[model samples]
Target: MRLAIVLYPGFADWECALLMAAARTHLGVEIDVATADGATVTSMGGLDVSPHLSIDALDPAGFDGLVICGGTVWDTAEAPDLSGTIRTFDRDKRLVAAICGGVNALATCGLLDRVEHTGNNAASLAALHGYRGQTHYREQPQALRSGHVITAAGTAPISFAGEILRGLGLGSEELDGFLALYGREHVAATSAG
Candidate 1:
């Protein structure tokens, strides 16, 4: 499967990294990183990522799934055009996943109105007031899945990617093997903690 991950000027790096790792390891999926512009995308932590495709150059039909990473970019009142792009992908039946404040983009495009989802925090949940399927995943600690939409809380990129892998029908054993092969200490830490 082909996955398209959208990047922006201020996206979260860990979110992108974890999802890309999941796509590569569990499903052996081809991941194409795209940006609103062809320019290098930078994260809030000053990390720079080069996208494989520009938003204007992307074909919504080419991807089996699309994930939008959240960060400071979504906190603004001015809506981004990327929301429309995500909406187009959703209309095409591509699996759409949003992480953290990325839900803001989905909300702005009206995609979250009746779709189940979760966000960064209580304020983030409040922001998605018009959304009908909103739920808090305190016990599980991550908004893993809600129908076709997969939403995750802030900084939970690893779990978010795992949920996506599960949604794509990749077994947990495969994900565990991948994590082991990749020397991902975070999983170990999570398990131990």
Candidate 2:
């Protein structure tokens, strides 16, 4: 399977780390990173990533799915408009996943209008000038999936990864095992203080 992952300035590197790792390690999926412009971008955590292509250069038909990483850039009026790209992916029934501020891209495109989706919060999304998908928002504390669209809150990267793995058609047994290991490590680290 081929997946297109979008990146931008100040993206949350942690959000898609597990998903990309598991996808490559277990599913053997091919991932191509992209950005609005075909250039290197920096993450919120200060990691630099060079995208394989620009969003304008990507064709939804060439990939099996798309993943939009969250960033502070999503809230800006100057952020690149990816609505057309998202619409193309959705029209083909390809998996579309977003987290945190990334959902703002989907919201801006009206992709969440009729789908059950969760993000930073309903209010954060409602704050967008032209967001008309408020009624379809879910107040879940974790990830929620509706049809081909999957969304999650900023703090739920593990849950986000689990759902994306599910979208990848990874077997439940494999998914559960990976999540169990991830959860244990995460809990251990957070509780070590």
Candidate 3:
């Protein structure tokens, strides 16, 4: 499977690290990092990311899913307008996942208005997010998947990645193992002790 992961200046590296690593190394999925201008950008944690393509250049038909990573940039006045790209992905029924501030992108595109979704918090984002999806919001600590759309808080990368893997058709057994390993590493250590 191929996934187009969106990135930008101040992108939250922690929010998507596990998802990308696990998806690539364990699931063998192909990932293409996209930026607003197809150039290298620095993450909030100071990591530099060189994107493979520009978000504006991507064709939804060429990929199986889209991943929009969280970042403070999404809350700013100059957030990249990814509405067209997100709409195309949704129209084609491809998996569309967004986390934390990335949820603002989907909300602004009106994709969350009909689907159950969660993010950092609804109240804090309501003013910045003028979208009408409030009634469907679920205040969960993990990621929530509705139909082809998946949304999560910034702190739940494990659940976020798990849902993405599950949506990509990974078997339950494999998912269980993945979650077991990542979701509860301390359990394994304690059990071994």
TM-score each candidate: 0.80, 0.92, 0.93
Instruction: Answer with 1 or 3, whichever has the higher lDDT.
Output: 3
Scored against the true structure, residue 103 in model 1 reaches a CA lDDT of: 68
Q: What overall lDDT goes with each candidate model?
A: 0.72, 0.87, 0.89
Worst 10 residues of 1 by lDDT: 131-140
Tens-digit lDDT string for candidate 2 (49-167): 98999989878779988999998888787777889999999998999999988999899888998888999988989988668888888898778878889999988888898888788
In candidate 3, what are the lDDT values of residues 70-165, reduced to their tens digit?
997987888877889999999999999999999999998899889999999988557655589989999999999998899999989989998888
What does candidate 1's lDDT look like per residue over 1-193, in tens digits? 8888887888887776867876787468998888877789889899988889887776777877888888777777643656667778778877788887786777666776666566676565555445443443333466567655788877677668877777666658867666555446545454454
Q: Which stretches of candidate 3 lie over 4 Å from their true place?
A: 185-193
Candidate 2 residue pairs that clash:
none
Candidate 1 lands at a TM-score of 0.80
Runs in model 2 deviating more than 4 A are 185-193
Task: State in Å the error of residue 98, model 3.
Answer: 0.3
Clashes of 3: 0
Using lDDT as the measure, which candidate wins? 3
